[model samples]
Target: MTRQELRHKLQQVRRNLPAEQQLAAAFQVADKLEQRLESFVPQETTVAVYKSFAGELPTSPIIERLWQLGFKTVLPVLHPFAKGHLLFLSYTSKTPMTINKYGIEEPELNAQNVMPLSEVQVLLMPLVGFDHQGNRLGMGGGYYDRTLAQWHNGNRPNLSPIGLSYNEQQVESIPVESWDIPLPEIITPAKHWRF
Candidate 1:
C-alpha cells in the first residue's frame, strides 16, 4: 500500500480500539519502557518525548513515571521560524502548556528552556506506523524528518531516536522517502523491536 493509504488504515485501527484496551495497553507500554530504558540512559538524563495526540499510544503515564524515576523529560515544540522542524524544550508537570497550530499539545516555547538535541539521550517519538527494519511512517508533515535529518545522516552519534507505537501499528513494510528518518528502536505494549 501507499504511504498515505497505509497511514490511514493503521490510524483507523488505532482509533477503533476500545477505551479500556487503550488504557491497558498504555500502562503495559510504560512498564516495558521503564524496565528497558535505564540500561541505556543514566540517571537524570533528559528524554525527549511527545504529548500523545489522536489515537497515538498514550504517553501521560510514561511521562509521570519518568519524573518519579528522576529522569528529566522534554517535549517537542513547533519551531516558530523554522518551518517543518521541531525544537526540544524542557517539560515538567508544571510546565506551561499550549496548543500548536496543528492542535498538538506542547510545552510553551521558551528560549531558556530549549535544549539542544545533542543533550537528549533518548527521544520517544510518536508515529502512525513502523516496520521491523525501523522505518517509521509519520504523520506526513515532515517536522521530525527535518529535525532528525542530521542524526539520520550520521551527525548526532549521541542521539537515540525511539518510536512509541501500538502493536497494531506495526506493518510488513513502510514506504520510505529519501529524507525519511528511521528509528533505532521502537517499543510497543507487546515487545521492543531493535533495528
Candidate 2:
C-alpha cells in the first residue's frame, strides 16, 4: 500500500483500540524507554519529544519516567516566526500549554525555555508509520523533515532523532522522499529497533 493508504489504515487500527489497551501500551512503552535509554544517556542529557495526539503512542508516561530518572525533557513548539519548522521548549507538568494550529498541545513559547537542537541528545520522533530500516512516514507536512534537514545532511551529527512507534504501526517498507531522514533507531512497546 502507498504511504497515505498505510497511514489511513494504521490510524484506524490505533483509534479502534480500547482505552484500557492504550493505557497498557503506554505503560509498556514507558518501561521500555527507561530500560533502553538509561544505559546510554548521561545525567545532564536533555531529550526532545512530542506531545502525542490522534491516537499516536502516548508520551506522557515516558515524560514522567524521564523526569523521575533525572533527565531533562522538552516538547516541540511550532516555531513562531519560522514557517515549517519546530523549536524545542522546556516541558514539565507545570509548564503552561496552549493548543497550536494543529490542535496539538505544546508549551507556550518562551525564550528562556528554548533549547537548541545541538544541545538535545535525542528526539523521540512521532510517526504515522515506520519500516525496519528506520524509514518514517509523518503527517505529510514535513515539519520534522525540514527541521532535521541539517542533521540529515550531516551538518551537526550530534542531534539524534529516533521514532516512538507501536508494534502495529510497522510496515514492511516506507516509501521515502529524497529529503526524508531515516531514523537511526526506534523504540516500541515490545522492542527497540536499530537501523
Candidate 3:
C-alpha cells in the first residue's frame, strides 16, 4: 500500500480502539518513557513533545510524568512566521492554549516560553505508523520531517528524536523518501524499539 493509504488505515484503527485500550496505552507508554529516559535526561532539561490528537497515543500522562520527575516539558506550537515549521513552547498546566488551523490544540504563542531546538534533549514525536527499522510515517504535513532534517544533517547532534506509537501502528516496511528521517528510538505500549 502507498504511504497515504497506510496512514489512513492506521489512523482509522487507532480511532476505532476502545476507550479502555486507549487509557491503557497512555499509561503503558509513560511507564516505558520513565524507565528508558529518566536515567539519561537530567532534571530541568527541556523535552519537546506534542499534544495528542486524532486518536494518536495520549500524551497527557507522559507530560505529567516529566513534570513529576522535575523535567521541563515543551509542546510544539505552529510557527506564526514560518509557514510550515514549528516552534517549541514551554508547556505547563497553566500554559494558555489555542486551536490552530488544523483544529489541534497548541500552546498559545509566547516569546518568553519558546524553547530552542538546541536546548531540547529529547523530542517525543507523534506518528501515524512505523516499522521495525524505525521508519516513521507522519501525518503527511512534513512538519516533523523538516524539523528532524536538521538533526539528520548533523545540525543538532545531541538531540534524541523519539517517536511515540501504538502496537497497532507497526507495519512490515515503509518506503522511505529522501527527507524521511528514521527515529533513533520509539516507545510503544508493548516495547521500546531502538535503531
Candidate 4:
C-alpha cells in the first residue's frame, strides 16, 4: 500500500482502541522504558519527548514517570521562525502551554527555555506508523525528518532518537523517501524494538 494509505489505516486502528486499553498501553510502555533507561542515558540527562496527540500512544504517563524519576524532560515546540523545524523547550509540570497551528499543545515559546540539541540525550518521538525495520511514517509534515536529519547523517553522535507508538501502528514495510530517517529504537506496549 501507499504511504498515505498505510498511515490512514494504522492511524484508524490506533484511534479505535478503547480508552482503557490506551491507558494500559501507556503505562506498559512507561514501565518498559524505565527498565531500560540507564542503558541509553546517564542520570539527570535531558530527555526530549512529544505530547501525545490524535490516536498516538499516550505519553503523559511516561512523562510523569520521568519527572518522578528525576530525569529532566523537554518537549518539542514548532520553531517560530524556521519553517517546518522544531525547537525543544524545557517542559515541567508548571510550563505554560499553548496550541500550535496544528492544534497540538506545546510549551509556550521562551528563548531562555529552549534546550540546545547538544544538551538533548534522548528524544522520544511520536509517530503515526513504524515498521519492524525502524522506518517511521510521521504526520507528513516532516518536522522530525528535518530536525533529525543531522543525527541520521552521523552528525549528532550523542543523540538518541527513539519512536513511541502502539503495537498496532506497526506495518510490514513502509515506502521510504530519500530523506526518511529510520529510528534506532522504538518502544511500544508489547515490546521494545531495536533497529
| Candidate 3: pairs in clash | none
The TM-scores of all predictions, comma-separated, are 0.95, 0.94, 0.97, 0.96
* CA lDDT scores, all candidates in order: 0.87, 0.85, 0.91, 0.90
TM-score leader: 3
In model 2, the runs with Cα more than 4 Å from the true position are: 40-42
Off by over 4 Å in 1: 40-42
Best by lDDT: 3
Residue-level lDDT of model 1, residues 56-167, one tens digit each, is 8988888888888889889999999987789999998899999999899998889999998888888888889998899999899998888688787777887778888889
**Residues 108-192, model 4: lDDT tens digits:** 9999999988889888998899888999999999999987897977778998888888888888889999999999999998999
Error of 3 at 195 (Å): 0.8
Model 4, which residues run further than 4 Å from truth? 40-43
Better of 2 and 3 by TM-score: 3
lDDT by residue (tens digit), candidate 3, 76-101: 98899998899999998999999999
Order of all candidates by lDDT, from best down to worst? 3, 4, 1, 2
What tens digits encode model 2's per-residue C-alpha lDDT throughout 1-195? 777888888899888878788778888988877777766554778989888999988888878888888888889999999998999999888999999999999999999999988889888888888888889988888899987787878876887777888888888898888988888888888888889
- For model 2 the local lDDT of residue 88 reads 92
